[model samples]
Target: MNKILLSVLLIFCGTSVFSQDTLLTILEEELEREFKVLSKAEVPVYYMDYRVEDETALTITSSFGSLMDESNARMRVLQPTLRVGNYKLDNTRELANYYGGGYFGANQAQYLPINNNSKAIKQVLWRVTDFAYNNAKERFQEVKNSDIKNEIDDFSKEKPTKYYEPPALGSLDESYWKNTAKKLSAQFLGDSKIISGTVTISGSFSRKYFVSSEGASVVQNFNFIQVFVSGEVVNEDGEIASLYNSYTASNEKGLPSFDTLMAETKSLVENLQKLKEAPFAEPYTGPAILHPRVSAVFFHEIFGHRIEGHRLKSEQDGQTFKEKVGSQILPDFISIYSDPTLKNVEGIELSGNYKVDDQGIESRRVEIVKNGKLQNFLMSRSPIEQFSNSNGHGRSQIGADPVARQSNLIIETTSNISDDKLRKQLIEECKKQNKPYGYYFEDVTGGFTQTSRYATNAFNIMPTLVYRVYADGRPDELVKGVDLIGTPLAMFAEIMQAGKSIDVFNGICGAESGNIPVSAVAPAILVRRIETQKKPIVDIKAEEPILASPLLNKKN
Candidate 1:
């Protein structure tokens, strides 16, 4: 979500003159001749950087109306980011009493020369920067023979940034997204209890570049386009119902109309045949509403990986708000904030809109919970305890290594009300907790959380539209399989009210620095109790399908 304009791409050039761009003058002349011979060896490196990227893609898939695949790609990767011992202590810190010192010993995302040659891209950036400075001098000699004595700071001294953005190219058509995935997978071949009707369609384009020995010269450009649509069904209690819906854009005229993706793929094949005739949900607890895209994946996996400031100096993580900064944590009329320089909000599009971070800093806006106290945390040049630097949300993916993740989070609230008064306060908190039906959830395909210390700080989510809401006024049923579990300070101490319409989700977000792109934004709320379970049945009877679909043949 970048594709130009960081003040018109940093007003053209001059972050140390990027030497008329021959791949940033051979990556800043091999990062100043390999930092003058690694600044004279012996655990010296201090810091370094390089990043690369390039990318470029296009994909398409379809199912019921055929065309299974189509692709076109391009590559270039790289990554290199080394730091030995300094920035207050390095080897990328967090060895916690040294458990075999790893610090990227096998570095990753190498391959680079999608041809801008300069001696084959400085010989694969001088052999991955001499294997990332001999794995940062063997993890800085195990953090200088650790008898473990640490006081924060394994790097946070920012001040090197010189931006630029020139090389830009992104164009897709590829037969109009392969006929828009065969016209939305031929509308799931008119049902026949649709067992799998797909449609994919992708588009990427990266660019990146970067460089530094602490002189940082950047370049950026991103662009995405997505449109997915899925369906799968089984029903009659053999239980296997799936449903999907996606659409992100930063181009392709900001995506949407194709009759609005064929009316959301015919409402995702009529919600996969009403989730194969609903009814499965059992383990409940009480009152709920969620749905501002399922509370934006329930506050991105229950409160965005517990405020990532390198997981409060990981002693195996679970640092859930490390001493809750200013306490509260939710419901003073809620607040949250993340903003990777927000690209779009009221109009959607935000796969974490970046304009720098992957550690050349830049992006900002991090408030992390406001009215409900708690305050700041998503930093990145790693350094916790009253946060040190990086509000840029470092990020990763393309060979992992930057962290402080979550990007466009958002949240807000301020006592809003009305989605019919948050569903009449979720049936008046299920008739004041005597609960006779309450849930809602509606739409989600992402969820996962356990902030470490070896799991179970809890969170599950995984709902793909749920429902219930009764309390004697009947109607509103459609349930299935369960799951939306809890425990993020007991689900932010049972929210209680929000609504006034807002939404958005966007995708991709693995962790420990891997699958990037993210976004959240919320609104619908109501909680008051929340909890659920039952959702594990996975046998797929050896993936059923004993012949039928020749477009559901009764002789076609």
Candidate 2:
């Protein structure tokens, strides 16, 4: 955390030179006023917190060498979280507060876009604070009448550390990115099989400020840049298969050179071409090898989402890991952890790095598993069972409330083998299981998991490229139309081995709260047993090809 330095003008938050104090004097004054009034009300309030986010973003997108959209905007929001009751049942878990809505709702971010005048900012804060206080008071009364008691506290005790830093207002060169995206998308113009091609260049700079009645104060900023290249074609069986490559950096200096990007672009076209003629895969249940990138995504969706502390308290969630904290949930050689403090590893900048979480707690590395045994859950201020304090995992989008979310997830292994050895081991397992060949997952676009009680406790990860490695020493054959799937508990037990090298995946994760940036790092792993289901593609073929362009005319 950096110290705040007052500037001469407030360019982003407010439109005046006098509103330049990095101390957030406007926020302090409003919070102090509300705390003094609400804390001593008929139904006394225990805590009240205020959060504000100032985000400035620019996006440039192109398709087939033509600019599609360009956006440059700035936004700011003020949100107040007021609570009643000691720790058992606060305004947070109450149903009445949300149903009896006022202006926006009992719980919603209050917009303060016109912050040029101090009175305007304070006026919005006063209304928001008053509504929240009333909701908390009514909810606390309901809690007193109920007989059920909670196993864990509604809120964790405050652990505050002073932090402040004036964010940098970086000037963006939009024309540069606009041209870069055009160049990347132009690569697919000459390809006949490619159905669609697009590229998007995105950059953002954001700063968050937090102050609570409990004496917590913080300010921090982040910079993010990403370039995405994507294209796709229908396979022989009329199934859509695509290839995507993303380049991430902390700034323009970290981005790959144009020549380097072109090379990657060439590879993407070649892979998509192969998928055009590749045979469709049949449903199979056997052994498989997940590449480093695919494995990172697999563990992230299958295991990481289940360990969030808030899931245990929600009656609608699956709560898969709630009862297995002390048990061996994975193979003996594997351990996993998450750290948002790490910005770069081996020259690659991570997306999940942060100084302090949205709730004003300093980010730190948390050990989630030790020797395959579950250790602790990813927690926000909301506590559950044995864990009662935040470990800096609370995260969310600008206008959403904070929740426990994954950060820079890293998977560790005590026993590691080479990539070649891992593949050979997979083949050996396939033969033992009486299967002719095993699947090798090359790349994954994304994945989703279902943790709600009503849905099946399963995960399905869509793969972009997969090949069959024969057990009898034959060349690997490309295939399509299979999705990796299994139950979390069973899949964790089938881990056969892990590779020596590590790779990282950076993306955004969306949950009940909102979409938050995250990263997953891990090595390739061989799973002894798993299953794949065929994609439900349209069985009928196209009646006639409008342009039997060489790529699609092969069926003739």
Cα lDDT of model 2 by residue, 328-388, tens digit: 9988889999999999878888998988888777788888999999988888888777777
lDDT, candidate 1, 167-223, per-residue tens: 676777888788878988888886666768888888888788777787777888888
Model 1 misses residue 357 by how many Å?
Answer: 13
lDDT of 2: 0.80
Candidate 1: TM-score? 0.38
The lDDT of model 1 is 0.80
Q: Each prediction's Cα RMSD?
A: 18.9, 5.5
